[model samples]
Target chain A: MMHRIDAEALAYSYTSGQRVLDDVSTHVATGEVTGIIGPNGAGKSTLLQLLCGLLSPESGNVLLNKSPLEQYTDRERARLVAYMPQSVSPAFSLTVREVVALGRFPHLGPFGSLGTPDHEIVQDCLGQTETSHLATRDFLSLSGGERQRVLLASVLAQEPQLLLLDEPTSSLDLPHEAAFFRQLRTLSGRGLGIVVVTHDINMAAQFCDRLVLLGKDHRLVNQGGPSEVLQADILTDAYGSPLLVGEHPQTGGPFVTAPVGGI
Target chain B: MTLGNTRFLLLLGLVSCAVIFTCSIFIGTETLDLGQAWRELRSLTPLSEAPTLSILLMQRIPRTLAAFLAGGGLAVAGCAFQALLRNPLATPYTLGVASAGALGAWVAFLLADVTAAIPLLALLTSKQVMAFLFAGLDVFLVYLLAARRIHTSPAVLLLAGVTLGMLANAGIMFSRYLARPDRLVNMDRWLMGGVDVLGYQPVLLLAVGVIPCAAVLLLQAARYDQFAFGTTLAAGRGVNIGRLQTTTFFVGSLITAVIVSEVGPIGFVGLIIPHGVRLLTGPSHRLLMPLSIVAGGAFLCACDIVARRILPGETPIGIITTMVGGPVFLYLLVRRRFSDWNV
Candidate 1:
């Protein structure tokens, strides 16, 4: 079954009273991949966090399955909307398996002993993320790429219907970053709604079914399919730069590049 | 969370704690052999000529139990505070809560004779009420200054806490200097923490303070373990971050205050025992927390024995814990290096 989350005309500002996001609205549905793409200080991260109930918009409300997001308890919302942070600092030397098992907390009883089925799910997530070999290793000792994968596995253990990620591959090399997006595509194939915030516009154009382009003013510039939203004029206007859009010679897909000033 | 290894480790800890507890009860200034203890237990007379029975009933059991409960309480409080503060060096007193509580207790002793008209205040006594209030004041100030914002630097927290702690300690010293000559010895004894208590009052005092608070902490052990991943990530897993942090600070500080009022402000048990137990049990709080309690109890019991035997007169157990734990803490730091501490 498909699940949906909608945001009405949302606006938000930080505690310092600086307006960061304004009049933004979007919807994400299962079996589809959406990307929130923008330049620095565009509040893409803030918008994604609002969608996942991490931050409440000052003016608008988020709806999950036609009910207000705030109406649901934290555990209820968490069981459906799983969020993966950009980076994490492990306070203790927990094993990869232990870190993954924590995702089952919303499902566990008050006593919180992970039963065999919970362990099995954790093991499956590790296998799904291809980190099974590192399950017994220390989470803190892993390299940046490996740590992101492990953290992704931990988020997957939540069995969420809607997965919201904030720069999930920001630290990866090219191959690993592509691999991470491909993994997301596979998960979306299994009827999951995935929303990601990233700086890589061309990568989003290649992977996401829909693009929510945020402009320099932190407002929604455009929202539609990649072919409609990834035009040269919209790209340049959103990024405050002269970005040239063209076809990838290899894949015959949308390829975007920004012209450096000296060039 | 695997039961196999955890069960074995727990059983081993329990056995060691029990053995050491028995030895602690038996080894003291007046030694009673096992056979004599057995005979005393078998004796028919209630209080006649049974030195073993009197010593066991009057001295050893109470003293040992006091050490056990205080050590257990301090260790659990330390674990909770460390998790909340995200700093491994944090103890029950790191945020200055217990120091303020101790200073309140010292003043309460000076003002013991004053009668209060309020029934509730009179019932709980000035020392306990003052200790709790001052501990609360310390948390309020520390939270306002250092932890009101979650992302405050660790160096700021350390500086704020240690500076406030020094001020409270100075208050204690100033009061000590102005005190009458007759009160000097009493002030000196309390300044150095000890379990040289006699009778069941200390044990009862520690149990009253430690049991419920420790239970609250143990119940939140799994939640605290999730805190290792930091607040934002932990909250992503459905943890109510606000509730957890509030409970940890208040409950941990209250327990620290209770011990401070009862047996003076003992240190190092809170600072080092949890870290030592973490080495054995890894970082899972389910294992690290309870095991620290058992290990801490056994450790302090043993320390009491050493304190009794180290010199002709019993040195304060606080001196022994610092003497012993200081070296161990240094060794741990030297081996682990500054790289391990993100703060």
Candidate 2:
């Protein structure tokens, strides 16, 4: 494979003796969108952090491009994997352009100024993320959806082969959510591997090429195409509540909904 | 700002600072003619012949320079503290530099009283050395407390600093109670903060301390800009957060100690100047740092003029800064919150 990330039987626990993840294993290849879906506290966020090397695995290891993640320098690893965490409020009102330019830090040498080519790449990212018009606008003044797009543009500016997003659409409304996933699909088609931690099962089923469902005990319940993983029995077990699973009326993919009655 | 415009603004800022510096020397308590002063300055003449020259060289020049250095140094430290702590309310004094330095100075006074014969122990009596040591101790304590957390928040660090300051203030009070009543006058004078100048010695000492620290801070201006985003985001952008925070904390506090050693604790210049500069030049430290330094220096020098000349008597320079800066900063903060400027 051109680019692949693998985690082998990984585990982690916080200092308070609460286990966040246990013996989890997964692999994501380039040109695919992998959706990680589970109920709250299933260690979905923790797993994503481990995969991106933001948090080291406690008992196992993560391999990026066939090399142990710990072996790569921060600069080299950043160029290979760009991570966009949950939404953050900036301490100062930096312009969107200034915020996006920060993504070039890993690429630029010490005391290096942005050159013409770097500017072109930044502009390209802004355009792709549809934030070109907001370049001069203050980042703090933007709407939640717009802020997500600008921050995503910052991640894209790194030009990583793999993109890791945690709850990227958590703050987005319906239209923005759909548009964001469509953009992710477009990026995946363009040969960038995307791994997203999301709670919306219907959207995950609709967009993801593969889905990894984590159960309440922080172990993988199932991993397959969305059609196979989004079964009613598995959804109920993973979420600890009754869920209605059926075919999408328009897209012919698995669609999930919460049952009106109790579990 | 666009590149060309920012360059122009920076150049304009430097020129204005130069004009202010020159005018401050001439327009002090004794107004000396500029031409004669320039001739004397250029000639390097002996101080005994020209009375204006003697006062200018012996007193006003060094005093003005000290005011500028301390003001600029404090402002730069303030900007670094605000950025490093990610809090607008944070200043160089937030980490207890003033209180700790005061405590250290008190201890020095006590030691000087008890051990008048020992030369090495006598060295402890220098307010500068005592203040520096206590300031260093404060920083070390804060670092020790905050570094234990995996992701130390600004609030945590600020809390640690405030607690340390309160403790140091308590120590100073105890020392004052134990010492002779006559020595209380010296302690009180040091606490009031003045740009008292004898010759270039104090100015030289401040320069040797402030310049290198300010240079180190200026080099990190772009990184400071990145830190405006929260720490985690900045780290994802390739900044080594731990190293940046530690270096900035020590250097910023070092400059504060250097200034406090020279002129006690000059209140509000550090807090006021950075906020004012942000309004004028925006929050990018690359522009903000140099401008803050120059503007802070000029601001203090002008304030010292009012203290020496316009005030009824010899008012301490720190008093004038608080009197002027407190209201101006309050007005700016209120207006900024309502205006397009980000809080």
Candidate 3:
């Protein structure tokens, strides 16, 4: 019943005077996988940043646990929300375990070293993300899919109540993308709120409990369960083209197919 | 890159440092008379009775201490610079702080000669103080320009440092032209980098300045590891990036400044030690930073011994480091595949 993160009428503009998000209000609830789905440049990433308090909105407020997000210290916010950006590649030859251990920084003191329990959590997270075998390997040598999973394990080690990911599957192959979403679905069942920005409408429909569609103008156009919001006309208008909405043959969930020619 | 075998390597390094440091004190121009030195060391004889003790106290001890300080300070500063810039080639010298410090010392030399009575000239004549002042100025200028333009991008900071260094070098040339011909050789000698001082003051000063900076750097080992993941990920992991950048830049420059002011820019130690240690210890700063400091200090101390004994006359320490560092750097480069630069 409690909201993990609530953004009220958030707006943001770059220094070049170009607005990214305009009057966008959204909230992420516990134990649900919420997907922000839209075409390119819909400000989904910006909205996620605002929710994580990485960027302050030009107007409106983001609250965490009923307190203004800005009031929490950087370490406190990091402990509450785990965010994984779109790209993470090691510039040095750090081992995979070292990379995942970074997620425990917010919980560590200035001179504190990792103790037994911390190692246990790191191992558990690595196993949950299917990366336990790669713990001793060099992070720089991992394949793209493996790298993303390792990064996900790192974020999971933060042990936050809210998890935010930005285009995590943008570079992944089809099978890996499906596997990643399945992992997220499994994670959401454990009662953590998950918000992911994705362009794959079908995956959003199949795995996400709710979807918020953003238009090109950087406004939230519609929000609801997959069957209620994935209407043909709404998606066509949102994407600026003709789209077909259908049901998955077996699961009966919503599916999307862009038409070859506009009607 | 793993610490599993590094404990053995670290133990070997520490023993070598101790052996070199002790052997250096005994093998000066005149071999320390062991019987007399032992008596003096045990306090069985007074200073006037034991000439070997005077030689050891007045010359060998301070010189060894200076060499150790210069080597350790530069290497730790090198590690910090490389991590902050995310570039292994980013040594403290790359930032132009050394050149500016040298220019400051050059100006002080000229002023001390032109006027013998002024109290201000008396202070500047120390040369070390003057070098620190100028290094501070260079660091300030680089940070100011970077913050105003690119908000402290590592690439921008590197460019700014190189430009400022070139300007300071030009100032050095102009000062040299105005300097009396007799003082020109003195300028050249200072730049050559020697640790032949005869008193305890400089050694004490260097130790007091370098140890705290090294401690601060060691404390940030975890943060440096996060920085290897890129700034965005570092911040996501709760690192205060702005504060980390400022603290590292300030402390690294200060360490380099104090060492350069004391012994001039001992070239290549900064660049070589970190790379060498990284090869053995991997990239975790927790093990990399402190090990580099110890290895660098021992390395330079050993080089000084070679400089003192290899030829009839002593060669400058900088020349020795370059001669050694150049080949090692080449080996590292030749061994590395282009894929190592993938990140």
Highest TM-score, which number?
1
What stretches of model 3 exceed 4 Å from their correct place? A1-3, B1-4, B40-50, B108-164, B330-343
> If ranked by DockQ, best first, what sequence of candidates would result?
1, 3, 2
lDDT of 2 by residue, A1-263 (tens): 47989999999998788998999999988899999999899999999888878788888989998899889877788888888888776777888988888787779775536788889989999999999999999998899999999999998988889988999999899899999999999999999999999999888998999999998988888898999999999989988888988889998888999877775
Q: What is the DockQ for all candidates, taken in turn? A: 0.54, 0.43, 0.53
The clash number for model 3 is 2
Assess each prediction's global lDDT (C-alpha) against the native: 0.84, 0.83, 0.84
Ranking of models by TM-score: 1, 3, 2
lDDT of 3 by residue, B81-133 (tens): 78876767567776788888888777777777565688776876657677778
- Candidate 1: what lDDT? 0.84
Listed for every candidate in order, the interface RMSD values in angstroms are 1.9, 2.4, 1.9
Candidate 1's residue-wise lDDT over A50-151, tens digit each?
Answer: 988888899998999989998988889889998898888776677899889988877887667888899999999999999999998888789888898888
Best by lDDT: 1
Candidate 2 residue lDDT tens string, B27-89: 766788767877887787777876777887878889989999999999998888777766665
- Return the clash pairs for model 3, or none: B1-B281, B1-B282
**In terms of DockQ, which candidate is strongest?**
1
TM-score of each: 0.93, 0.89, 0.91
Q: How many Å off is the CA of B141 in candidate 2?
A: 6.9
Candidate 3: residue A244 Cα off by (Å): 3.4
Q: What is the lDDT of residue A45 in candidate 1?
A: 92
